[model samples]
Target: MVDRESDTYSCECAMFEHMGILCRHALKVMVHVGVCRIPSHYILKRWSRDARDVLPDHLKCYQKDSD
Candidate 1:
């Protein structure tokens, strides 16, 4: 369900809450509501390309040097 006034969306799948990615149901709701852009809150930082730009000293060894 989507509430246009509050700009909130809910789905019975709970995919977003558990997996941090919006499910088809939510996407459909957004489309139906004419949402052109994804709301910032729905974008998970960990899933972004720059998510690991900064790494801890210990974990740095596991990362392949860009250069």
Candidate 2:
């Protein structure tokens, strides 16, 4: 059934783990629903290189002035 396939895809794509971003399965659903643009948040998250910057500035010991 289509519902089962969709559910499987959603699980496989890990959509439930990240609601803020669409997994590939969600994108497929969007295509089925005739959605375009795929939203900047999703695409941005996919292509973003900023994930490495999530650590706090203070966490970088080298960046602190030598005591």
- Model 2, position 9: C-alpha lDDT score: 28
Q: Runs in model 1 with CA error above 4 Å?
A: 54-56, 62-67
> Could you give me the TM-score of model 2 versus the true structure?
0.36
The global Cα lDDT (0 to 1) of model 2 is: 0.54
Best by TM-score: 1
For candidate 2, lDDT tens digit of each residue in 1-67?
Answer: 1343333224465654666566666777767866666554445443466544554677756543334
Writing each residue's lDDT as its tens digit, candidate 1 over 1-67 gives 7877777787999999999999999998898778999888888888887677777877868777643
For every model shown, the clashing-pair count is 0, 0
Q: If scored against the real structure, what TM-score would every candidate get? A: 0.75, 0.36
- The CA lDDT of each predicted structure is 0.84, 0.54
Q: What is candidate 1's local distance difference test score?
A: 0.84
